[model samples]
Target: MIETIVFDVGETITRDDRYWASWADWLGAPRHSLSALVGAVVARGQDNAEALRLLRPGIDIDAEYQAREAAGRGEALDEADLYADVRPALTALRELGVRVIIAGNQTSRAGELLRDLDLPADLVVTSGEWHVAKPQPQFFERVREVARAAPSATVYVGDHPANDIFPAKAAGLRTAHIRRGPWGHLWADDPEVAAAADWRIDSLFQLASIAKG
Candidate 1:
């Protein structure tokens, strides 16, 4: 039986529209242009941040992040950013006695914001806190360490196939490919993604049944 359900932050639990919009504003680029660039890079299998680099050649992303924070316009999150199904789905899963966790590649500040939202989760963590991001074996290792459960009993759900499905599956955890974000919709129909994911869900609401089964 699945004893734990771990979630990816962006697109899984929250919409990333605000995230990219903020970045576009920071870079003084049109929001639509940056959004299009993100999709383009993702389609080419390049990092989405590459869009920023494309906009400003040789840009130091970390330094820019710090500058944005100092300017009081850095990463921001709130209840409004959450998906409609997030609360109901996570609550339903937890009510079923399944441990729910939110883990993803996000900044430490994003982690703080997520906690502030007071979502119904056992723990909220990020790659920034662990100093390790997904698609890395160590990241999943850390996840297993925190979960304190057998890999087989844990489920990692996310919208990214490369970062979430493939790596988590390789780490011995069951993987669920959630079709909700840019990456989610783009790769939802890929054969490799379908093969890697133990479950393909259109909404978080489906997790309760998966946890029960």
Candidate 2:
């Protein structure tokens, strides 16, 4: 039985098109260009930050982001940025007495940002805090260790099959693919990605059904 459900923050539990679009605008790249670049990077089975930097070179990411946060634009996302299905699904799973975790490979402060949002997470962690990103055995190991969960008893939900699904599967956990965001929908038909997931659902509402299974 799945006793723990770990989630990827962006796209899976949150919709972030506007989030990336705003950054693209701020960085003087066309919104679609940024989006396409991200898709291209993921298509190559690579992380998207390198694509962002490639699209807009020589900009100090940390400095620019810090300055923006200092000026109150906020650090990437707020509680309002979450997808509509997130709250109800998380609430449903929690009501089933399942342990829920929010884990993301995101900006250095993403873990803190998620924790501040009053979201339904018993634990929130990030690659920034752990100094390790997904697709690495250690990252899943961290999740497994902290949740006090054996991988077999865990179900990881994410949008990116390259980074989330395959790795989690290798770590011995089941994976659920949610097709709502860039990478999710972008690689929906990808052969490897299509085969990686044990479950596929278009919305978080489906998670409730899995909670009872």
Q: In terms of TM-score, which candidate is strongest?
A: 1
lDDT of 1 at 183: 93
Q: Which regions of candidate 2 deviate over 4 angstroms?
A: 58-60, 70-74
Q: Candidate 1 — which pairs collide?
A: none
Once model 1 is optimally superposed onto the true structure by TM-score, how far is the C-alpha of residue 209 displaced, in angstroms? 0.3
> In model 1, where do residues sit more than 4 Å from their true spots?
none
In the range 79-197, model 2's lDDT, one tens digit per residue, is 67898888788888899988999987876676777877878778888888889988789998988887677787799999988789989988888889888777888777778877888
lDDT of 1 by residue, 1-213 (tens): 999999999899999899999999998999999999989988987878899998889999999999999999988888889999999999999899999999999999999999999999999999999999988999999999887679999999999988899999999999999988789999999999999999999999999999999
By summed lDDT, the worst window of 10 consecutive residues in model 2 runs over: 71-80
lDDT of 2 at 136: 87
Which candidate gets the maximum lDDT versus the true structure?
A: 1
